[model samples]
Target: MRFKYSIPVVFVLALVIIEKENNIISKVSDKLVLKQPPMVLDSSSSLQLLLKPNQSVPSFHFHPRTSAPVFTLMKRRLEDYSSHQPRTQKPKQKHILLLATTRTGSSFVGEFFNQQGDNMFYLFEPLWHVEKMLTLEGGGTNASASAKAYRNVLQQLFLCDFSLLESFIDPPPVDHITSNLFRRWSSSSLCADSVCSPFVQGDFEKFHCKARKCGPLNLTLAAQSCRAKQHRAIKSVRVRQLDMLRPLAEDPRLDVKFIHLVRDPRAVLASRMVAFEKYKNWKEWGTRGGDVPLDDDEVMKLKGNCDNIRMSAQTGLRQPKWLRGRYLLVRYEDIARFPMRKAAEMYRFAGMPFTPQVKSWIARNTQVSPKEASGVYSLQRNSSEHVEKWRFSLPFKIAQVVQRVCRPTLKLFGYKVVNSEKMLTDRSISLIEDKVFNSL
Candidate 1:
């Protein structure tokens, strides 16, 4: 008797051998859900089986030759995927850092990246924890010390290493788990099911979060989530200067892009007064109806913020060797008026695909009534209407003081100077100049 091998027999043997030799899922028998193919299939050429929803896994079939009638099933080898192939250079990952101060529309702009869907892991003020923990631990808040610590924490976080972050959390998390991630709810990637669970209550108080049951997300789990993401973005208002971030930006292991966001200095002071209780004194001073000297501690504090903002932008605009093709300057006023257009630019600058989801979010967020997004930190707003609210809120005298103190910054960024009280309050007159600030 002669031994003859049929195509089915050879195919079964091949599938078994592939399964034994490789780590990839053997598509024929694994319970993987089959997705519908784009076209009808045939055996003469390799083709995907058209599948319906809930369809069972199907065999992959092909004919070895045009003259033969034999049909065969085959499993894709582990090496078949482009990702598994040996490469001379690894693909660069997008790591974006949005540098801005409080009241510069940082939160609003951050949503552009955060809503890029599941492939993005967003960090909303991870430095908030570092700042709080350092303050409690007696770590001085001097510029050098603070910037150094911030730089270190950011570097590790981008790498998905949570240990450095865990060390900074007060009332340390147990077994690399914690519920106190600052606004942990803000990052959907962190709140995903694989990394977090419903908060439980006890002496330790099982992570009870009101907005979502998610709490006590494991640092290990968070790291896993971050690693799974193709890109990471950090939005922070605490970084006083762009130069402080040079080490992280220049690291050979990472590709980092910076979006330097700025707003008018006078508007910043006006918004800060309403949003921060610590500014009550400044509020009182504004309401006291007198000339505020440029040298007042409060005024100087505002001036310092302006100085940092201007300097950082000027540095980025210069496009230093380190920052070339990695820096962008964005004004809140421009974004407020054309939310979707500016969002596309920022996404392009970061070298990330601009997704339809972000476009939809911008459309909904920018056109809504202010009441729906009126909270001090709410991301939603009628953007065009909201930017000018500060104009009416800041008294003329206070505005004049800001103009004098933040003059250099204001002029550098092309804000129209209001020469009189009437010019300051007239909403009919546009205060923002139609000048473009380029980072290239």
Candidate 2:
């Protein structure tokens, strides 16, 4: 069997090389500069842009090496604030939000963005309330315990200093002294309304407030916050909640942007199945809905749920036109296959300053080459060819049942359905007979 890295191996090597070149001499002591410069028009770049529901562009250009701002700027608060200050020095802050789904490579993207020196503070999914839930789950703490815990977590995270994070990853200070009282006070005074406190001020404040004094994040008015590194990016999957976003959008201080990512249901499902089989051995004892092997019924239902989520997201995006262009959908297939080009596109969309480093990074990390195997569901790649294994991985009748259950919603996201007549055809029968014969 020709086993290789699940994603492109070449891209991984490029990343390692780039890491070494960037003075990432030690893994533990240094935080990798994860973020790339924003996208600009590069004539040498390739890969086609897949349009979102409301984005309109005549022609998109990918530059080989040019200083182009990657994303559309809704507004630049710090730059404006600096204009009001004494001309002795300039002040600037950039706030970026990466609105993504689970398993959409957000952490990788955030890591790239975090490398912008002290200019950008990349916040991982540090929602403390959620983190503290393991303990909370043990008892009936309060009637609104979950909500209160979530709120408290948000408050703490928003107030925590992000600069300390870089140090945490590569600690110079054994126990970096931070004043939690100061943070709590800062959290209260900075934004009064608990609901609008983090950004206006809400959950994220649980993380962002402390950076004000403990680290470089100075707690000044939005107009005067000149720690150029004042700019921050939140990479969290939970931000998909529209209710959560609506409040943050209302905050006058924040220049919020959303980057939404998507993937083909077929590809996602295939990858997920492979992951499940490898990790859980779901096949050996059967799956959740059945004590016996999964029937077609279960597989079909899985497909339907996946498709429905994507379609609902698509539909939901249309109603909120304010999120147009700002809320971009990235296909996982494109990211895996043409990472450099895709990275360039994302840089451009985010309005960050793109540099040669980005080009070098893309050349190294983007998966621009063809894939040798589409994955486990293939013949030539491996003898364990479950390629379309969905056909035989489950009981034939159950598989059919799953297909029927999920059929209505499956095609919307690009899944093809095999009719009942075709299931009993010569090819299908032969494949099944072979599987059953092999088993005996």
Candidate 3:
């Protein structure tokens, strides 16, 4: 008897796509609830990295020919490695780093790669470790020295290349889509462990951050061992602290990939305002003190927070043009345009291998349309209506205020405010008051 293989056998071996539209049970104003794919991997392969309301697990399937390994198998292997377990002796060279502001789709992008198995480690907020020395034992009694240690720890953690240190710093970058300021810091000479700036002296340390005991020597060994540790790494951190990343990126060992994910200001503003309004006032809504009602000062502080992040995001996109070859600007509109294409490009940019199954997995799980079809087999285009829904969703007065504040930045991203004349003419609404119109 001869062994025979057939297409039906291949199809049977393939994992079917899951449709998620009907499953989208909730829709928050500006934020759309993505339908979860029914075809989830086993719990062992699933990662708990995602924040709630957007909790997702990366899924994979195997190729039919050559009995290629199942996507899920790769996912499991990676999970083991990230958690610090050994899978294979061979080291992989492709490492990727993603840099972006909050709410700019960095989380989702990181998640996409993470689902691919032991290839990429999704490191969120790599700077937090260094910044935490102020609270840790033996960090330092003096604020200045403490700050230096904090910065040093962060540098070594990210650049030193230890799997254990991955817990402390973001993995190296094969690609980085970071803000201009962050790119500046990550590329700075002063960020090194040895170069303790004056800021790390006297009172400066109290205000700034530095790394701890993990200096250049220990970091070097870690870096050598973990150099080819993960297939790739993605870093999505706040823009305010980008200045710290300067030194580590200088090393020839670090390969940084840049991807800028931007959303239309109107939508971003709408989404943010709604989130704040709902969460900030939760206590008043009787959620058992879950939400805190903020006074004018608090509201102002929140507004500033929003403005800072938005400004950082805007600056990140603009700054890369000066270094065009190293960066790629991707709009939320475009990513939403054909998420699969954008995802594939991102994978290629990160130097990771994109399996056919991964492509299928994205199509099925990332469906975001009115239609109910969602699964590895189905694909949908980005909803244009969602792109500028803020025009209608946000109140006119608030929209005006947002426009006043965000207009200049919006222009930087290639968008112009709709002037009153254009709004009146376009909507065909008379500007004159009703009484004046009647008298006329």
Candidate 4:
């Protein structure tokens, strides 16, 4: 009986020993696995892994001993994932807002961008209607509200949305007769391009019947086409301050850039005086006299305009970093003097290639004698001759007042103040005369 019991105990002890040996072997195998470098999946291996059976999957993780290669694999996988992912589309359209005051050659600048052929759609003072709308809404005196509305309107206009403009269609801004004319012309052009003869006939019922199907009648086709173009630009002298457009300038959805077109105050005053004289009988004339000395009201108006110019210059110069590459300060005098060079610079700033077609347009529009260029509101001009014409034409008293009111801005823009005789004799050019001088 003792022998049998001892034999059973011996068998139990043997079983325990075998189990201990198996545990030791398993631990050694694990150590060996840790000693080897982690396996990383290359493109082919990764693809194979993707194809493999779900239950027989290799581990994506590595042994703790090879943490470095594990991280490398992680980085590689991330790169691969990014490379294989679908790319997001970027905004195709770009907007250019020409920030300028009245009589600062903004119209010429507008025409320059407009004549960029089919790829460019140019709007002349789209904000005039906004101002009128603001007045109608009784928010004219509230600068902040007016600015917000103006920016909102600009956003819609840039996106080629004209539904908001229907409200202002019936009785548009009285001061914007030119804006009305442009609307009529655009409507006529769109109708000509897309509408049938029956739609255009005097019979209102037939026109209305066809108009429902012809969507171009509701919105500007030029503007709609512009949405797909390389560039869309708008020029406005109504905007008195650059700060008012800070939101638009910094918007990422719309690639917006600003061209601050400035003119010498003395020259601007002289032009206004000349216009005042030419259109004295016109009720819409902002200035009262031309040959006669400036009345108190006229002087005050000139002073206010000069102050606005100064403010705009200061605002542009102090732009933040985001606006650094977007804001371009251009002088009317410089553009007038060197049309081709300045235009090329402008195109570069606007991210457009300067084609031979653009060069041809500049040459055709700008090749005119000073005598022939006079009394015409056109892009063609004897630019060099036009630059200093204000010096000879402006009266001495008027010059002094403009010089005094615009002294700070004159200095900022590199314009010099001189006596009447010196103004005629001195060949002092624009202070900021360099083609590539973008202080902003």
Model 2 Cα shift for residue 433 (angstroms):
32
Q: Per-residue CA lDDT of candidate 4, range 35-86, in tens? A: 5454633333332322324323233345377665442443343345435656
Candidate 1 lands at a TM-score of 0.77
Model 1 ranges off by over 4 Å: 1-91, 136-140, 201-211
Lowest lDDT sum, 10 consecutive residues, model 4, at: 173-182
Q: Write the per-residue lDDT of candidate 3 for residues 117-148, one digit (tens) a residue.
A: 43333344554544442344643244455445
After superposing candidate 3 on the true structure, give the runs of residues whose Cα lies further than 4 Å from its correct spot: 1-92, 126-230, 241-244, 277-324, 368-386, 419-440
Clashes of 1: 1
- Weakest lDDT window of 10 consecutive positions for candidate 1: 41-50
The top-ranked prediction according to TM-score is: 1
Better of 1 and 4 by TM-score: 1
lDDT of 2 by residue, 214-317 (tens): 22223232212223345566565543243335445444555555665554333344345555544244343335554434454545445545554555456435
Evaluated against the true structure, the overall lDDT of model 1 is 0.77
Query: Which runs in model 2 stand beyond 4 Å of their true positions?
Result: 1-92, 115-118, 128-230, 269-281, 285-308, 319-325, 367-440
Measured with C-alpha atoms, the lDDT of residue 340 in candidate 2 is 60
Better of 1 and 2 by TM-score: 1
Model 1 lDDT per residue over 222-293, tens place: 888899899999999888888888998789888999988899988888888999998887888788966676
Residue-pair clashes, model 4: 1
What's the best-to-worst order under TM-score?
1, 4, 3, 2
